[model samples]
Target: MTTDTLVMPSVTAPPHSHRLRQVLHDSGYALLSLPVGVLFFVVVVTGLAAGIGTVVIWVGLAVLALTLLAARGSATLERAQLPTVLGRPVPRPAYLPGEGGPVRRLLTPLRDPQSWLDALHAVLRLPLAVLAFSVTVTFWAIALGGITYGLWDWALPQEGNEDLFELLGFDGGTSLRIVGYTLIGLLAAAVLPFAVRAVAVLQAQLGRVLLTSRAATQAELGRLSRGRDAAVAAEAVALRRLERDIHDGPQQHLVRLGMDLSRAQRQLDRDPSAARTTLAGAGVLAREALEELRALSRGIAPPVLADRGLAAVLAALAARSPVPVELAVDLPGERLAPATENTAYFVVSEALANVAKHSGADVCRVEVGLVGDVLRVVVEDDGTGGAVLVPGHGLAGLADRLRAVDGVLTVDNPRGGPTRTVAELPWA
Candidate 1:
């Protein structure tokens, strides 16, 4: 037998490599800030100047409006460039659209608060950008020049000039000059990345604060609120359903078993044969209740899931299923988040249970895999199909549970043949 080993490139970057990459990005961004800042400042200042100077005529109103629009455009460009420094995209905010005539719409930028903020950012950023550019460039120059001082020292005019060490008044020589400057170079090099990143962040942060959209933020908050409410509702519904199932299934079975055992004890003294029959019935009821309780426990956080993860637990579930199940599941090597694994487990468990109870199919097929940033689970069966998501029903409960985790469940059950149920959850 021959063995083939295929090597794959590692995806996780080393700490030092990541640090170097970030430093390069910060350095590039910092170096570019001065020119970008200058362009913004000059444009904004000139436009405002012309607009204010022409205020005597109605033409000044149009100038001021156009200037505000230009400021907004500059702000947009600045925001787009920030992700290279911040390592994330800035949210774009919604602007108010004016109703009615052409002039009101043209002047809409003046009325918006975000537009004003953007314009303010354009004006204020120039000073910070200048500071950042000076510090970053000075530090880089010192580090480079000092480190390479020895290589270029002979070319400089040595007759009438004092080197850095000589100017300090201690001493002056070729050896001293090289060693002293090299030390300074090493020190500056050590702090160069941090210094550059700090200044770049200062400049980029202003744009983020001014340019981030309020509407986008509010939409995100609303999504989280809805998820919270769904979680609460789903938990309540699950608890109630569990209580109902216990009451109607194993709870009633145990009660009947107790009554049968009591009857058997009472009959034992008078009629031995009658007592034996009652005892046998009680034994059957006891076994049934035990099995039902075991099934309920399987739906919960089983130890196998924590030890062996979703794949193993799913294999066990498929083995126990009444309908023959063909499971094809591909998962990552590491364990998923606890809540995600639990939700996925229950989705499959409930889905298989439905296939057995309602589908009445000879065979069922289950496919599960991570599709990009989503965990998708699909169960299909060749059975008589009439499934629906009615309120307070199993399918409805599944829908609610999926929604709690920002997941969705859909079923395609036609009149007479096959049924397919698909559930997709975020890869949280």
Candidate 2:
């Protein structure tokens, strides 16, 4: 009878034991903030005083601008430091580019609102840093001193040690006093991690409110406004183009077919053979009209795209392209949102159309895939590439279409070779 046995390799502590590491990180941040905060506060305050005091002399303007620039730099450093404590990125504020010559550029920072905000943050941080540093250092020192009381208490002149212990209601004995101090030390040590974390979080939140970019909402609103305008103009243009196509193609064919049938009816009794020929011509015109209508419908929303998904639609596109196209598509089994699929399809269609019309390339490669939560489509061609997104151009229209859906279209076409057009849409 043999006993079943199991053996496992030795391992260190579990990954959740981050209390010590967190405490050390917070403590280090607090200590570093003190001197850095002091330095920023001094520089900013001095610069402001000097700039205002000497403003009539014109030297103040330069000093003020330089001070704001320095404040921006300090805010940037704070943003860089926040991610470790806050666990997320803080985007930098956007600043307007300075126009004109050397002196205008020098005074650019003074006109910016974000630069002033940064200066305010730099000035305010000094007091917050002082509080964090004092609290953190004092807690650590008390905790360590209490924990080591047993080892070092003997070195002290021990005349009144018993009275000290009795005052705390512990027995008047050396062992009791040592035990009490160790317990108090253990309690402080237990609270140290939490205290440091609280201070760090407070400082990080303050920095986030003051130093980080507040323009994201404004930027998004502007994008949506532009996108709405573009969408309206594009829709109007598309409607006009559709009307023109119908007028040129199917509408003319139908009119000619009607005329031919009328002629056929008139000649039926007088000349049966002539009527037959006219009827035949009418039938040909009818079929051509039907074909033109089908093409127009496909341009609007292809039957294949509705039936299958983007994969089948793209396969049909590849089959019909003027030049040889290498198609690669990796999509989810289920279909994407209708708008996303439609936008992606049109982007590819327009890009390929541009290639066929403008780019003199022998072969093109089209790649479509779901990259994370984004629908990405890339159309690349080896051609004489000098593509620019001029207004009213196909690429510009594509950009407008993409912008309407918060998608992006990028064209990478340099002179003397390959052009790569990429369109990305959010999958959601």
Candidate 3:
């Protein structure tokens, strides 16, 4: 009989190995908080004292302002360090700038709430750091000492000393005592990683709360309000433009068609030949009216855009443009949302129209691509560069349109030549 030997597959470590590494990293971060906290506390305290003490002399006010500025700088440094522990970007808060001359600027930090918040963080970090440092050092010392107790225990004078196992109520026999102490060491080692992580997380959270600025929320709210206003204005302008286009083009053609047909009806009985010519003229007017209507509709939403997407639509636009256009469009295989596509189309259309009208350039380049979750479009031309986003100008309307969709439009046109217009929209 032949015996078959089975080979076992090697087992790999689980996903928790990453967590173990993170805990180790966080432990080092926690330990570092001790020195950073102490240094920050001392600096802020000294500054505050000197500033307050000298305030009656007017120089104190300047000192106090500088102190607050220093506090803000320290908070910024701490903010930079957070990504290692938190694994995400922490946005810096905006500072309110003082207007006018150097004196106003010097005093600006004093009035800023974020600077005061930074000062508060500096003051509070000391106690938190002490707690974190104590936990880390105590756990590590106990764990390492107990883990290697067998080597060091014999070096200690054995006359009056009771072993750790005896103190812990374990039996004092040599073999059992050694096993018990080692078990305690093993338990400490296992708990050390978790303890370090917890303390580090707590300290990081405390810094985040105290150091980060609250002004970001306020700024966003203000931007949203302005965007809403811009949207309403843009919609009003679009409606007026649509009304004007209909009145100027299709409305006039329809009126002329009606007039021609009426005249043809009158001449049919008296002069049949004349009536035929008039009727032909009426047919021509009818066709013109129909063509104008189609063009207007196309301006609103091109049918080809819906069917084939942006690439095909842009190619058509390039072909139709008065000046030569170098077009490069790179989009994903799947279609984007209808709103995104429409906004992008209109922005490019308007920008190109402006370029053809105003920029006396022989050739222009249009580029469109996706950058992460943003859609970026750039239109550049060699033109007499005096483009400005003033009210009543095309660029102003373009800016409003972009703002409505949480996008932005920027124009760069120096006096000599070369105009560049960039529009960015969020893809998702």
lDDT of each: 0.81, 0.82, 0.80
lDDT tens per residue, model 2, 34-140: 99888889899999999999999999999999899988888888888887776567666677689989999999998888888889889988888988898889888
Using TM-score, give the best candidate's number: 2
Which of the two candidates, 1 or 2, achieves a greater TM-score against the reference? 2
lDDT of 3 at 140: 84
> With candidate 1 superimposed using the best TM-score fit, by how many Å does residue 362's alpha carbon deviate from the native?
10
Ranking by lDDT: 2, 1, 3
Cα error of candidate 3 at position 357, Å: 20
Candidate 2 overall Cα lDDT vs. reference?
Answer: 0.82
Q: Which of candidates 2 and 3 is the stronger one according to TM-score?
A: 2
Whose lDDT is higher: candidate 1's or candidate 3's? 1
Tens digit per residue, CA lDDT, model 1, 1-428: 11222222232322685877877777777778788778878878887888789979877767878877888888878777777777777677777778779988977877887777777777998998888889889889989988988899889988988776788886757898898988999888878877887787877877776677554565677778887877777677778877888899899999999999999999999999999999999999999999988877786668899999999999999999999999999989888878788888888888888888888899999998999989999989999976788877777777877887888999998899698999999875
TM-scores for the candidates: 0.55, 0.62, 0.58
| Candidate 3 pairs with clashing backbones | none
